[model samples]
Target: MTPLRQRMLEDMSIRNLATNTQMSYVQQVAAYAKYFRRPPQELGPEDIRTYQLYLLETRKLAPSSIGLATGALRFLYKVTLKQPWAVEEIPMPKRPFKLPVILSREEVMHFLEAVSSLKHRTLLTAIYAAGLRVSEATHLKITDIDSQRMMLRVDQGKGQKDRYVMLSPRLLDTLRLYWKAARPTLWLFPGDLPDQPITRDAVGQACQKAHRASGIAKPITPHSLRHAFATHLLEAGTNVRTIQLLLGHRSLATTSRYLKVASSTVCATTSPFDLLPKVEEPPPLTPTPPAHF
Candidate 1:
């Protein structure tokens, strides 16, 4: 790696950014440099603006993608190069507000059952059972399973925070069966290399195949299971603050979004009209005299 890249990596490490975040930042910066065919340090605000336009007009990247690229460029200039220009010059694109697609309990069951691979099925099941992100699920170790406490410890989840989520009795049974069959030594789901955990892409591929086999019309990704988990809990009457803690969301607003998608929660809610007093029907109006016309 070049000296500049090494320094940027060190800066990210010092701030304790998540591994996935660091990787994304590095990749985005590299892509930005390649686009201009010049070092990022030499580029200025005008180049960044042009590059943002290129991402929007030419590459047609999603707002989230452009935002990530912009963040990387901002870090490269402000943190790495120590540029005097204000970081706000690198404006992030506005991401559209789209509600997450939630699957009903039956749909979730059908999707999980369609997964053919035992390991993949177990991993996906655990994610739905505990409301875990793909990265957190993939990085799970054998010791993380606390059967006695009926909880699973999520280490270094998003934002580099550790937390515990409930372990359903049914899920524990499924995991026990998987453990006996696979006998994972270190990682709960070890990859082909043994030392490393299973890749998120592998889980994603499994979800894709399962979605096809299940014949579900709605999209089914690993994150979809997590969405279903949160919505289902909300429908079951779990409080937003509690769910926020369970999901490791820094903001309660993030967890409350599930309320919009929770069908039962939305439907079961009492409407304002229902609370209004009942009124008898009024008499039919008589025709008004028009003799003056």
Candidate 2:
């Protein structure tokens, strides 16, 4: 039983899955085992299907939850247990695609202005300025900033892959001011405890507070900043492929979604009203008709 869990962890690590993903997969698999009061290895495809049904019908879990369970089971059987046929027949539920929320440049400025703490403000600014996920922002180090090259290095980003993103001049000045005030020794945004980096929860709470203060009313989060970054860049005439590289996205399709969010795209299109031209009535139509008659 121990070996089964170990094997699953090994498979996850081998794939270089994101840390959050690794944790979620492990937890989901463990939950399945706990639900049956038996090791996951003892379960076959039928059991997997039943568990999925239980999650949906009995637990009334969200689609995302069900999807995670399906993914965990699939990985367990296919990768760890070496019984691909057992889980191959199980079908994953379809998830609805939704566009990310994006804040306009002015709204983002207002949100940033509302942040009281320098550390929190700078961290949030860096997130938008560099198009970083909150996790990446919180884990940033002084060494990661390449001032000369104007690039921010993201280590072990979303996919456990390292990548570089642009660093704006305004963001650089803000960081310099923040550094002078905080004098951080290790992590760029260190938590209250010296040993660890600032928690993602801290960044989230800051965003919530700022959102309330800004009165934007759009259900914004730190991620919305990243989305806004992409949308604004696209509006600024940046290429989608270039945005994809900057956002660390694996596919151009993922980056293409920003085209819809871009203000330029929305503004550049012809309006419905423009399609119908107003017609002027002929002033002398009656007189001309009478003359013709």
Candidate 3:
């Protein structure tokens, strides 16, 4: 069992999975083993399928939860156990399509203004300004900001891919002020502990507090700021491919969802009724046609 755990960790490390992902997968696999009261290696495809059903039907788990468990089990069987056929019978649940919640520009400003702590405010603003995930913002280093290039280097972003995002002059100035005030030694947004980066929970709590204070009503969150960022860029006429690159999205489809959130795209053309001039019905035209006939 210990050897199996070691192999799984090594494989995850090689794939450069994020720390949070690694922990989640580890926990999922452990839970599977505990459920069966035996090592995961001893479980067959039938057992895996049964457990998934139990999660969905009896436990009333969400599709996302089932997906995560399926992924972790698949990785264990295929990657760690070197048994690709073991998970053949397990099926992935269909995830429902839902549009991401986005905040208006004014709401975003209010949310930021409601944040009382300089560190928290700056960090959330950076996430929105740079279109960064909370993890990416938390892990940012001082050297990552390139004012000359007008880009911010996001090292080891989602899927362990490093990419560059545009830097707004406004955001850069705000960051400068934040840096001077915070005087963080290493991580740009270091936590109270010297060496540790700020936890995602802390960022989330700040967002929740800000949301309550602002009373914006819309479901505002840290990620909603990111959605607002992308949507605003699309509204400003930034192309989809360019946004894909900026947001570090691997697929064009993922970035294209911003089209739904962008007001410009939806509001570009006026209704046909509004284009026509108001006039009384042309009853005279009918009588004129009969006379010509």
Candidate 4:
């Protein structure tokens, strides 16, 4: 590897960034350098601006993607090179607040049932039942499932933190049946190799197949199951803070976004008008006539 790349990797390692994040940041910086056909270290602030514009107009990248690229470059210049850098020079694109697409309970049931493979079905059931990210689901170890306690241990989930999620009886039953059929030794959902857990892409592909077969056209994904889990819990009157803990969200604000999408919660909530007592306004005209006189 190049000295620049090595130094950047070390910097990211020192900061304890996730492997995925480190790779993305490095890749983005490499792309930025390649765009100009010149060494990134040789580039200036104006070059960064032009590249940002290129990503925006030429490449038609989404605002979130542009923001990620800008962040990567900012880290490269500011941290790795120790240059006089200002992140403000490259303004972040305004990201639209899109509510997550959630599945109804019936839709979720149909989608899960449509998954043909017994193993994939069980894996997805665990994800939806426990509100696990695909990464968390794939990485789950056999030992992580606490049958007696009725919770699943998620190790090194997003932000490299560990947490426990409630294990539903239905999910447990499915997992038990799957284990009996497949005989996975270590990983709860082992991949083709058996030694390794299933890949994230594999889970995504399985979800797509199930979605096509189920005919619930709400644009579902593995993460959408997680969204459905949170939304369903909120709709069922679970506390927002409890959902926050289950999802391992660092901010309550992130968990609270489900309120916008939870149909039951929105429908059940009393509006300000509904809460107010009725009052008549009949004395305004008499006061107005006296003021005019």
Candidate 5:
């Protein structure tokens, strides 16, 4: 690896950024450098602006992706290289606020059932059962399952914090059946290489395959199950705060977004109009005849 790359990696490591985040930042920076066929250090503010336009108009990257690339470049210049012009030069893209697509309970069941691979199905099931992020689900260890307490331990999740989520009895039974067949020693869902756990991409591919087989119209990514988990719980009248903790969201507001998508919550809510006193409708009036031209 180049010294610049090594230094940037070490900087991210020092800041305790998530592994996926670090990888993404590195890749974005590398792409930025490759675009100009020159070292990133040789580039400046104007180059960054041009490249942002290139990403938008030419590469057709989404705003969120451009924002991610911008974040990486900002970190590279501001944190790693300590460039004074970083803040003024590099601006983050504005990402639109759009609600996530959530599957209904039946849709989730159909999707999971359509997954042909036992391991993939089991993994996806556990993810939805516990409202786990794909990375958290993939990194689960055999010991993380606490059958006695009926909780699944998540270590170093999104924010490098550990938390416990509910473990369903049905999911536990499913996992046991999977264990009996696969016989994994360390990771619950081990990849082809024994030491490492399954990759997020693998889970994504499985989700896509099942989505195609199930024929559900809405897009189904691994995170869609997580969305379904939260929305389903909210619909079932689980407290938003409790769901917040279960989903490991830092803010209650993040958890509350599910309220917009929860059919039960929306339908069961009493609108202000319902509280008004009853009033009779006025009698309809006949249309006036037109005047002579």
Candidate 6:
């Protein structure tokens, strides 16, 4: 490795950044350098601005994507090079507010029913039944399943926080069948290679095929099942804070975003019209005479 790249990676490692984050930072910085045909160390803020424009106008990257690139550049200059430029100079784009896609109980059933393979169906069922992140569900080990306590242990989730999610009886039964069939040694859902968990891509493809077969027009993904899980719970009278713990969300606000998409919450709420007291209808309202007329 080059002295510069090594130093940056060391800095990131020292901070205990996740492997995915480190790779993303390195790649973004490398892309920036490559675009200008010069090492990142040789470039100035103006060059960074130019690259940001390219990402915005020419490449048309999403705000989150652009923000990730900016984060990488910030790390390279502020942490690695110890440059004098302010971190704020590398501005992030404004994040858009988009509600997550949620499926109804019947819709979820239809979608799950479409999966041809028993293994694939069970994998997805675990995710939806437990409200698991795609990554967390994929990484689950055999030991993580506690049928006695009816809880699923999720180790090192997105923020490296380990938490326990409820394991429904129905899910447990499905998992037991899968265990009996597959006889997995390590990962609950092992990949083709020994000891490796099934790829997120495989789970995604399963959802896509199911989505098509089920004839649900709305976009469906592995994460969509998670949304359906939370929404279905809220509809069933589960508390937001309870759902927060179940979903392993760091902030209540993040969990509360589901409120926007939760049909139960919106539909259950009484309208302003309902708040008004019962009244007799006026005998035929006389047409109001306009002052000008």
Q: CA lDDT, every prediction?
A: 0.93, 0.89, 0.89, 0.91, 0.95, 0.90
Which residue runs of candidate 4 sit more than 4 Å off their true CA positions? 269-293
Tell me how far the alpha carbon of residue 6 in candidate 5 is from the true structure, in angstroms, after superposition. Answer: 2.2
What TM-score would candidate 2 get against the native?
0.90
Cα lDDT tens digits, model 1, 234-289, are 88888989999999999998988898888776788799999999998999999998
Model 1 regions more than 4 Å off:
269-293
**Candidate 1 global lDDT:** 0.93
- The root-mean-square deviation over C-alpha atoms between each candidate and the true structure, in angstroms, is 5.4, 6.3, 7.1, 7.6, 3.8, 4.6
Model 2 lDDT vs. the true structure?
0.89
lDDT of 1 at 208: 96
* Model 3 weakest 10-residue run by lDDT: 284-293
What TM-score fits each model? Answer: 0.90, 0.90, 0.89, 0.90, 0.90, 0.91
Identify the runs in model 2 with alpha carbons over 4 angstroms from their true place: 279-293
The candidate 5 region of ten consecutive residues with least summed lDDT is 260-269
lDDT (Cα, 0-100) at 7 in candidate 4: 96
lDDT of 3 by residue, 42-117 (tens): 8888899899988999989999999999999888998898886856767889999899988888988989999999
Candidate 5 lDDT tens digits, 1-293: 99999999999999999988999999999999999999999999999999999999999999999999999999999999999999888988888888999888899999999999999999999999999999999999999999999999999999999999999999999999999999999999999899999998899898889999999999889999999999999988899999999999999999999998899867887898999999899889989999998
User: In candidate 5, residue 267 scores what lDDT?
Assistant: 85
Please report how far candidate 1 places residue 51 from its true position, in Å. 0.5
Worst 10 residues of 1 by lDDT: 84-93
> Candidate 6, after superposition: displacement of residue 169 in Å?
0.8
Task: Report the poorest 10 consecutive residues by lDDT, candidate 6.
Answer: 84-93
Residue-level lDDT tens digits of model 2 in 1-293: 48777777888888878778888989998999999999887888788889999999999998888999898888888888888585557788988888787888899999999999899999999989989999999999999989999989999887678999999999999999999998998899999897689998999999899889989978889999999999999999999999999999988999998887777997898898888988777677454444553
Order of models, best lDDT first: 5, 1, 4, 6, 3, 2
Deviation (Å) of 217 in candidate 2: 1.1
